[model samples]
Structure formats: structure tokens, C-alpha cells
Target: MSASSRDRKFPLAIEALALSEAAAPFSLRLGQGEALSLLSEDAQSLSLFCDVLAGFASPTCGKIFIDGQDITSEPPEHRAIVLVSPRDPVFGHLDVAANIALALRAKGAAAQLIDATVKKTLALVGLDAQNGHRADLLTPEQAARLKLARALAGAPSVLVLDGLLNELDLRAASKTRDLVTRLQRALGLTLIHAASSREDALWLGGRIALLDRHALIQCADAATLMERPSDARSASLFGEANLLTGRVLEIEDDVARIHLACGGVVEAMADAELAVDALCILCIRPDRMTPLFGALAAGDDETPPLVATIQSVLHTGEHIRFRLRLADGGEIEMRRPLLQPMRGVTQGALLQLAWQASQAVAFPMKDDL
Candidate 1:
């Protein structure tokens, strides 16, 4: 089936492509310093290349295309692709100007234009005043910004950023990423930013493609990915929630009525013929479910209720998560808090949790079905 372009197109007419991976292991760090030295050392002069845009250890095996043209066999420079990674691609001994110039030179740019482009790009990153300083003498954040500037200096059609913002604190990372995204929009550049977290991807306003077990399983916009994920793995990667296996117990107003293994019943939006012998999993976001403070309220008189005990309450800035233990020994989390303290329920209080039938989902419970 042909996927919709609703995802691949942007206001600036740039076409961004995303791919998946297969059997990829999560890399646990052994020595932080050792890993840093290797990545930084390999990126000495800001010259970098990757054949496949987004893949795991099999760049050549993955198909790549730019502007709707297949460029899997083309050189990185010819493809107008620049990659800025975790290890800043700056020259330690060379000044920032020279570092930026090297990138332009790699693309066979004229020397005269290099100086002007370097100044402009550096200014965009708030580092124009430090163009004369050696890259090694600059602070970690400064070096990172310079590498991003150098990558943008060439005015590539596509920019790939990987792991550069993960090291920063939340505030700084948020600001820097916003700046990069603004630049991308202004320059009409297609940006493919890869990060290990969905929070980062959401901040960049970029679509997410989950890679698990070296396979491309799910790709969609931030809202779609979170709301209607293709499978359980994709759902977990987006953010852990309640994925409960259940059977259909009732259907109401185009909603599938599911009964969980723990004898709890809930309603989810579904089509016809999903009742008998239909084994499915229900997806509920932690923040969406709420603890049952009392018996059926007047407004949501028809909403299904799941009785649970408060296992824990987590204060998460904008909301408080009430981790609850459901009647069947399973766990369900509900989030509350839109200013002011929540009433009635203490940390260990028992309450009935209720949610709208439309908020939940029922799908096949298989991992690779």
C-alpha cells in the first residue's frame, strides 16, 4: 500500500524520508570517556558521511532517496546531505572559521564565499564573535554549536543531526533545538534529527520512526504515533502505558467493549464483529486515565469504571500520575492535575478509575502479527 504524503511533505516543499532498523541492540556504555574520545577523534575536520540516511549498520542495504529521486548509490556531498553527530565535528587546532571553511571546501565551494557563509551561519548559532578562537579552546556547547553552523554553512538540501542534543540539560537543549528548527524552516532545509527519546523528537516537530530488532516497524507523525501506534513495541517506545490483553464483552455506539484478564471491563472505539473470541490489547496513556474518586458521576454516567488502589503518586510538573493496582492484580495509571491539588485521594487511597470509551483502543495482542 502507498503511504500518504500527508507525512512526507512540509510547507517548504521539502520531502523527508525515514527508515527502520532490524535487530538493533541498545548500546550500554562501558566507559564514557573512551566513547567520547573515539567519536570526537574520528570527526576531526567536520568531514562526515553516511550512505544510508537512517539505518543500523546496513547503510548500503537501506534504500535512500532525496527530492523523490533514489540516491542510494550517490556520494554524500552530491546528495546535499550533511550530518552533525554527538562528537562535535570541529578541528581542535584550527579556528572556528577554518573549521567552517573545511566543510565548504569539501563541497568544492569558492574560498571567497566560504568566509561570508561561515560568518552568517555562525551568527545564526550565536557564535559569530568566536570565529577566531580555536575549536578546542571553546566550551562543549560552543563546539557543538560551531559544528552545527559548519554543517549549515554549506546550505545543504538536507541536514541530519544525531545525538548532539541528548547531552544538554532540558532548558539548553530545548532552546538550541528550537533555534535549529527555525533555521531549517528559514532555509527551506529538510531536517532528519535522530534521538533516543520521543521527547526530543516531539520538540523538533519531526515525525518518529521506531527501530526495534533491526526492523522498521512504525513511522508516523508525533500525534498519530502516540495515539494509534502500529504495535506494542512502538507503543512502549513512545512512552510506557497500560497495554492490557482482553476479550470483547460488549459493544456500544461504534465502540468495542473489552473485558481484561483481570475481570475489568472498558469500552474502546471499534468496528463491527469484534465480540466473540476476539483477543486484543487495549492501549491507554498514563496521563489520560483518572482515578475513580466516587460512584458514577452525573456527566459521564455511561463511562466504564475500573476499581483500583493508589500504588503511587508521581508529581510530573503539569500533572500528577496516580499509579493504581486494578481489581485483577494488574496495574493502571491515571493522571490528574491542571493546577490546584487533587482532592479526596491520598497516596495509598483506594478509588474507582474511570475513562471515556473513546480514549482506549483494542488491537491484536501479537508482537509481529
Candidate 2:
């Protein structure tokens, strides 16, 4: 089924949007009040995506519908979709209030209406526009907020933010994300946020659209995308996942026992049909694998533990990252909370690592890898 046909029942704010430059075509759909984080590391592709969405550049082919209306040929102004960037064109000489009013004035809004709208927008974004601070003097956070205020002044149903949150540190980014999400909910606006990293995408807390090679590779929430990626590339993009090669030893109900190349057997949740001895890949997040410091206690489950030697340990503020080498010479990484007791763990120390059967995912092995 086509992407557009699958989402017919909902009132879409953006639909069947496809674009192309020198590589594969790009396509996506966004429903009203829904947020989509477009994940792309390449700055050029991200810029082009925003440009086409804002009507700054025409797509080589395909249509763009906003609010169920075809606005593929309409200029940016007529689409009720606003694009706000960190470096958005703002009149540096003008004060915050004037900058906020500029777009409304250009649209021929009444002077009183512009004043009222600008006042409300600035307040909504937590900015004191009456202070008359010049645009050139605003801090990065303030400036970003101003840009959002300006976009809101236009009363758009859709907001396209281009790398605006990428400039801030984690703390500031979290605050900005919260503010944007609240605004999106309060205003009933569809948001298309361009994110540069997996952390940023996860922090944005929305369905993510992974854009690679000028194509929409995958679209899903953070958990689904990380746990059940469509391919190896998508899995790698999530970062810090142990993608291990294994052969199916047996299948019982929804669980499959697999023999890992790393010299251990593990049971994983199996969603796909696999015959005995079929080669596949297992995806397990580092945090999901726990280290059993010593031998198992009496009456413990019969599942054998995975034994490995700790290769290295790094102390991150919140967790300790361990690099371990398996008996078969393969390596894997694991993360343990800082509060977890680390009694006998050290470099070159032998340890038993185990994880729940439901925590692992299996997929058909890709030939490229």
C-alpha cells in the first residue's frame, strides 16, 4: 500500500510529500498536532528538506498537501506552514517586538491586530517583548524563542524547526524540547523537527523519521526503532546496540534459542519464522545485559550464563560502561547503573553476563554485513 493510502482516515497536516535532488527520493506524512523528528546527520540534506517544505526550493517531483489541501505549487506564505531556523532572517536593527510584528505587517494585518498578536506571542514564548531588546543582542536561547514567537505570530497550523535545538546543550535542549512540545499541544500545531543526533531525536520524544541517502529509511518511536530496526544501518544509527550474529538452535512458541558466534546460547523474542540452524542477527541494547558478579545461587533458573572477561571499564556519571571479551574472541559492551554494586568487576576480570529472553531481538542476517 502507498504511504498516503495507509493514513487516509486521519486528518493529515502534511501528506505524500516527496522530494529528490541527486540521490534517492524522500517521502513522509505528518498528521495534525503530531510531531516527527527527521533524523539526518548531513547538513545539506537537512537544509534541502526544510527548504522544500518551506517552499524555498521546489521538489524535483511529487506533491505536498497541507491540511488536506494541495499546496505543492503554493508559496510558503499560503501554506500556513512556518519554518523557523536558528539563523532565520531577522531584522537585526529592530527590537524583539518589531521583529515579531514584521511578518504580520507584511501580511497587511491591522496595526492594532499586529500589536496584540505580537504581545501575546512573545508572552506565550516566555519573552518580554516590551523591554525593547534589540534582536542582535539576544542570547542563543532567547533568539530561538523569538524566532518561534515570530512563527507563531503568523498563526500557522504547522511549524518546521530546522536545527534550532541542536545549538543548545543537553539541559537547554531538554527545556527547549519541553517548551516546543507544550506549544505544539496548546496550539494544536503539527511539528516537523530536524535533529542531528540520536540523543536529540530521543529527547524530542516523538516518532522519528530516519533520513539517509536522500530517502526516508525508517519511521518509528525511539523504543521500536532501537529494538526492532528495519536494517543494520538503522540499528547502528541508534548507537550502542550489540548486533551479534547467531544461528537459530530451536524455536518454542514466541521464543527462539540461538547460538551466538561469541560462544554462548541466548533466547530472544522471535517475531519472524526461522528454521533450525538458520543464521540471523541478534540485537540487544547494552543496558539490557546485566553482569552477574559471581556464580548463580542455588535454585536459579537453568538458563546458562554467558561468561566473558572484562576488557575495560569507563565511568560515565550515571552509569559504568564495560567492554567485555567473550570466550570466542568476540566483544560486547554493557552498561550498569552507578548505584549498582560492582564488587568484583575490574579490567581482565571474568564475569557472567545474562539478559532476559524478551530483551533481545532477532532478524534475518543481511548479506552486506
Candidate 3:
């Protein structure tokens, strides 16, 4: 550990504990100095979750543990978790450095200690040169770093960022994210950042906790979450997924014979709970489907190739996307890297695609067949 790290408090761990019940009570565990990105479509939901974690709001019923101690009932200041949000109020009367000293002053910190800490933190967040600037005069990115520096000045065990990035422009948010991630690792600061998009969560590099409608859906690293999302809702949220309704025709080990509602029979990997005649939702990511320009592989006893009519092909410089229509008149999209050639394929052409049975997973649908 560096000298500064040794002088500061050791990094802390937090665990939001919940029983594995019907409500799926929203459990998350972060190791000491670990970072996590909490992603959700609902801004209010994210704020509420952060509120509960930071002790601004009490849970209806649950326990929140910090470093193995139950801190659910602790107030915001007592819990040692600091929350930084774009909506957090600033002191217009104070300059950048004084604004950061608010929390330090609140605790009756020594003037000398506060000065040294403020100088170090200002440099850490790259705001050292702007210590005298008025709060209102700072750019969006500078304002963001100011908030982070102030939060750090409080010496909180875990930092909760709620929709802070969404407050800035795209370029500014990207730069702020990179800077924060670097500061987080450098200081071994445990962080819980609420992200606005999948790209944001992935770029931040941490365990990702997904939420929808105020309910925590799934928690995993980016790759693991994308590969085996708990449900179709999660799969679609992580990336573009062609969700098709299907039924299990038969089962051979982990793979299932699926008869699609859109008029095709194929095989998909299934969990042990799936049985014959069960209604299922099959999710196929666009990039997972390969375009076959040569001889078609249409029929087989195992999983067969899928056929679609190319409605249009779009090249977005970075990648190629194909809009295809299925036999049942339903449409789906397929994306391929720019390196993949069209090979003379044109609009209204037959786009035969193949994929591994594992590439497309069929999740059990709640709807009765």
C-alpha cells in the first residue's frame, strides 16, 4: 500500500443481504475495495436504491451490512457511505475548495488537517488548479469532479454515485467515468456507481447489478450476465436480442427441440426445469447469427439453420446490421462486424443464418401454452 493509503482508513466491504424469496429481495455483496455498477432504466428507482444504501431512506424491511455489521438503521452520516448525485445541492457562497471542506468542517476537523486533505483530494480529482473557482463557474465535468472530491473529503467507506454521469454531456460523462474509475482503483475505494446504459456499466469494469421496475433483476460481471441472463427481459436489456415465442417439442439432455411460433423447428440449450410442451422464450443476439453465403444448412435432426428474407442491410461504419423477415412475417435484426463481407447479398435476398444451439437460449415463459 502507498503511504497515503496506509494513512487513510482501510477500504470497507458492504453486503446488501436478502433471502432468496419470491420477491427477489435485492441482495448484493461487494468485497473490500471492489467496484460495482448498478444499472437501471428508471432514474427514480436508482435514486431510491442508493438512498437506502446510503441511509437517506429506510428500507421497508431488510438488513444492510457494512463490513459484517448491520448498518441498516444507521443514519447517512453514521453509516460511513457517501452519496454523490447531480441533484445534490452546492454552496454558491463558497469557492471550490471551501465547498469541499463543508463535510470536513461539519465534523470539527482540525484546520491544518483539512487543508492538507483538501489539497490532496483536489489533486486526486484533477481540480487542484481550480481550487479558487466559484462553484457556478465550473464546467459540467469540473462540477462532477468537484462533487466527487467533496464526497471523498468525507472519507466515506463506500461511495454511491446516483445518475451523476447522466447529468453531463456524452463526451464529458465518458471522460468523467474514466477519471473516476482510475481514482477508485488507485485509492482502493469501494464504489457503487449507477449507470445509465450497458456501455457505461461495461466500460466502468465491475460487477453489474441490473434493476427493472424497482426490482433488482440480476447481478454478474458483464460477460457472464450477457451470456446467461436470468430472463428474457435481462437478455434484451444487455444487448439487442431477437425474442421468439416457442415450445419445447422434445428434450435430449441439456438441449431442447423447439417449435417456433414463427414457423421453424430448431434446438436450443435449456435448463433442467424445462420439459416437453413448455412455453419458452428464445433469445438470439444479432451478432451470434452467422450469414451463410454459400450452400445452405437448412435441415438436420439436430438444431437446423434459420431462414429469413433480407428486408434491408445497413452499414454503420463500425458494423453491419441486417433487418430480416421470418416466415410468419415477423422481423428480426442481425449484426455482424464490418470485417464480414456481404458477398453479393442484397436486399430481398434469402438470408440463411446458422448459430450454435448454446448461442440461443430458450427461457421458460410465464404465459401458459
Error of 1 at 67 (Å): 3.2
Better of 1 and 3 by lDDT: 3
Q: Which lDDT tens digits does candidate 1 get at residues 1-369? A: 222243233211212222233333221111110111111112221122222442222341434545444555666556655677764457899998899888678768787888789878888889978979999899767877887888888776567677677667777777787787777666666666665555655665545555554444566666877777776666666755577788876666778877777655677765343454578777777766755574543334343456677888778788777778876787776777766356766766767655687676667656563
Sort all candidates by lDDT, best to worst.
3, 2, 1
Candidate 1 achieves a global lDDT of 0.61
RMSD of 3: 5.0
Q: Which residue runs of candidate 2 sit more than 4 Å off their true CA positions?
A: 1-28, 40-47, 58-60, 87-89, 129-131, 169-171, 197-199, 202-205, 222-240, 273-275, 294-307, 326-331, 367-369
Positional deviation of 66 in candidate 2, in angstroms? 0.2
- Where does candidate 1 stray beyond 4 Å? 1-51, 54-57, 60-62, 75-78, 226-236, 271-275, 294-305, 338-344
Q: Please, what is the TM-score per model?
A: 0.76, 0.81, 0.87
lDDT of each: 0.61, 0.77, 0.80
Ranking by TM-score: 3, 2, 1
Give the Å error, residue 331, model 3.
3.3
How accurate locally is residue 6 in candidate 2, as Cα lDDT from 0 to 100? 56
Q: Extract clashing residue pairs from model 1.
A: 21-214, 21-215, 22-213, 22-214, 22-215, 23-213, 23-214, 24-214, 292-352, 292-353
| Top-scoring candidate (lDDT) | 3
Question: What lDDT is obtained when candidate 3 is compared to the true structure?
Answer: 0.80
Clashing pairs in 2: none
Clashes (candidate 1): 10
